[model samples]
Target: MIEAHALIKRYGDRRAVDELSFIVKPGQVTGFLGPNGAGKSTTMRMIVGLDRPTAGTVTVAGRPYREHTAPLCQVGALLEATAVHRGRTARNHLLALAQTHGISSRRVDEVLGLVGLADVARRRAGGFSLGMGQRLGIAAALLGDPAVVILDEPVNGLDPDGVRWLRDLLKGLATEGRTVLVSSHLMSEMAVTAEHLVIIGRGRLLADTTVSDLIDRVGVGSVLVRSPNGADLRDLLVRHGAEVTGVEPGLFQAAGLDAATIGDLALAGGLAVHELTPRRASLEDAYLELTREAVEYR
Candidate 1:
């Protein structure tokens, strides 16, 4: 688990992170979301002790990252996949990190295979493609089998297949009761992979809720109803206090009423209903609505 209390970070006069606090628990994937310049990178850096917090504290598995005897075994992070040395092979890069913590060569090979980098293990990292480089970074992250995993844009250079593989890998890690906190702008993927979310805007905590709860809070969902008697249905729905809009000659959308309620109302009005489907807001929709005021980069 990872915990942050009133965390603050400042660069000269500007505050990058301001009084942020959130708890990321084990056994589930938590998504860290925000618009550009929302202090997400700064916050992630602070979590792993890449940057010191001006105030407050952040701990991984009950203590600050520096206090752990085997820091890599407690938390593994991929803040910058391109930070590796260009002269080293993918296997050499991981082997170097493994040696720092006394991790075995056998385990290094295991992670290489786990990340599908065994084929390119002997290849120099500088010559690797963007996707291959990302795979190597992930290999280093899982090298210690840490209890907590932190990744920032892990799918940045991945193809569709790699994206799918990463989604499965993150879910699998969380299933093992590891505390997984991933930052990504891909709302659709997060909606499927993450059970909970910690949203920040301008370095402040905006929301810490589940994916379903966040969508329900926006409450922008509507029910689409199709019928031959569209006009009549629209009038009836409006009279029943539902905000109705015509989509076409035979279809309408209704808000402030659920599908079941609309179906019952249409049935009571003796109207023939061809279709009634609920259209809840997507994760992207909710994210935009919530961070509308918090966006700094427009």
Candidate 2:
């Protein structure tokens, strides 16, 4: 598991991270979410020991990342997919990392194949496309088979198929009991991939909650109603404090009330109800609501 206790990072007068604290448990995927300039990259850098925190502590598997004898084996990260040397082949790059950790050529080959880069193992990283670069970076991260995995914007350049493949790969890692933390802007993908979320804004912790709970907290979904007497039903619902909007001759949307209550009201009002369905708020809807005030880029 990964833990952060009152983490803080500052640059001159501006604080990049401030008193942030959270835990990323194993056996599940935790999503790091924030708007631009929300200090997500800064936090990830601190977690991997790339940036020094001004105060507080962050540890992976019970210790700081730098304290580990073999840090790569303790935590695998892909903070920047394009950080690789432009001149080196994908295989050789991973081979160099593997060599440092006493990992074998066989394991390098295994990770290369695992990331679907086996065919282009000899190709130089400079020639690889954005998607291919991401794959190669992922291959390097898995080379050590670490217990904790952290990735920043992993799906930045991936296509639909690659995105799905990455989703499965991360899920598989969590299935193996690895602590997985990934940061991404794609809410639709994060909705299905991450079980828990750590949301921050302006360098401070905003929420730490599960996907379902987050949705439920801000999810006041509207109700769709179909009735033969739409006008009469709308009037009755308005009387009961429902903000009703007409969709057509026989269909309408109702808010400030639920389906069951609307159904009961319609029944009492002698309205023929044809359908009463509640549209649950989606992850995107909830995220926008929670982060509305936190968005830095507008």
Candidate 3:
């Protein structure tokens, strides 16, 4: 598990992360979400001890990342996929990382196959494609079978097939009871991959909640009603405190009311209800609502 309590990071007069606290528990994938300059990368760096916190503390499996007996074995991270030695082969890079913690050559080969880079294991990393480079970074992260995994935009350069594979792999890791914290700007993928979310903006915590809860908090959603007696239904709905907007002659969008209520009103008004569809708020909608004001740099 990963616990961050009142974490803060600063560079000169600017604060990148400010008193952020969130727990990334085991057995689930927690998505770390924010805008481009929301300090997500800075926070991730602090978690792995790559950058020092200006205040507060963060721990992986109960201790600071640097304090662990074998840091790599405890927490595996992919901060930058392309930050590798240009001279080394993919296999050699993983082998070198394993050597730091006395990890075996067998584990190196295992992770290479696990990430679908076995075919290019002997090729120089600099010559690999973007997707291939990402695979190698993930391979290094899994070399020790670490208890905690932190990946920043793991699917940035992946193709559709590679993206699907990564989704399955992350879910599998969480199922194995490892703490998985993934940072991504892809809302569609996060909606399907993450059970929980940690959303921040302008270096402040905006939300730390489940996907369903976040959607609910944003608002149940507006209801779409298509009726033959649209005129009467609109007046009836407006009188009932619903904010209704006409999409066309026969279709209207009703907010501050549910489908059941709208349908009942239409039926009571002798209106022919053609359709009463409740469009639930999506993750994208909720995210935009929460972060609209908090966004920095426009």
Candidate 4:
């Protein structure tokens, strides 16, 4: 498990991460979300002890990463970019990492194979394409076989197939009861991949909730009605204490009434109804609602 209590990071005059606090439990993938320049990198840097927090503390498995023996074996991370030396082969880089924790060479080959980089294990990393570099970086992160996995923008620059592969891999890792904390700006991907969300803006916490909860909070309830007599139906629904809105010129959105009840009302009122569809709130809409004012740039 990873827990942060009032974490703060400052640079010169700016507060990069402002008293951000959240707990990421094992057995699930928690998505870390924020806009550009929202202190995401800084926060991750602090978590791994690469940057000391200005205030507060963050612990992985009940200890700060820097305080742990075999830090790599306890926590694995991929920051902004894969920092592999251009001259070395993929196999050599992973071997180097594994060796740091006194891990065996066999583990090196195992991770390389697991990340599907075994075919190019001997190829120069400098010659690798962006996607290949990402795969190699992921291979290195897994070298320690750490209990906590932290990835910053893991799918950036990946092809469609590569993106899907990473999604599956992250999910599978969580199934093994590992703590997976991922920072990403990809809302659509997060909507599908993340079970919980930790949202930040301007280095401050904005939300920490399940994806479904956020959706429900913003979605509330809305009814989609297709009928020629929309005007009449709107008046009736409004009179009955239903909140109404216009989705389009003709179609009306209704709240406080179920489809079945709406249909019965329409029939009793002798209205020509063509369709009635309900739209539950979506994660994208909920995220926007929560972070709309938190965005730094237009």
lDDT of 3: 0.92
lDDT string, candidate 4, 93-211, tens digits? 88788877899989889988887788999999989888888888887778889999999998987999988999999999999999999988788899889999999989999999999
Residues 157-208, model 3: lDDT tens digits: 9999999999999999999999999999999999999999999998999999
User: How far off is model 3, as Cα RMSD?
Assistant: 2.7
lDDT of 2 by residue, 29-130 (tens): 999999999999999999999999999999999998999999889899999999999999999999999989899999999999999999999999999999
Better of 2 and 4 by lDDT: 2
**Clashing pairs in model 4, backbone N/Cα/C closer than 3 A:** none
TM-score of each: 0.87, 0.89, 0.89, 0.86
lDDT, residue 295, candidate 1: 93
Give residue 163's lDDT in candidate 3 (0 to 100): 96
Model 4, residue 249: distance off in Å is 8.6
Error of 4 at 208 (Å): 1.3
For residue 211, what is the lDDT in candidate 4? 95
Instruction: State the TM-score for model 4.
Output: 0.86
Model 4 spans with C-alpha error above 4 angstroms: 220-223, 229-272
Lowest summed lDDT window (length 10), candidate 3: 262-271
Between which residue pairs do clashes occur in model 2? none
Q: All predictions: root-mean-square deviation over Cα?
A: 3.1, 2.6, 2.7, 3.6
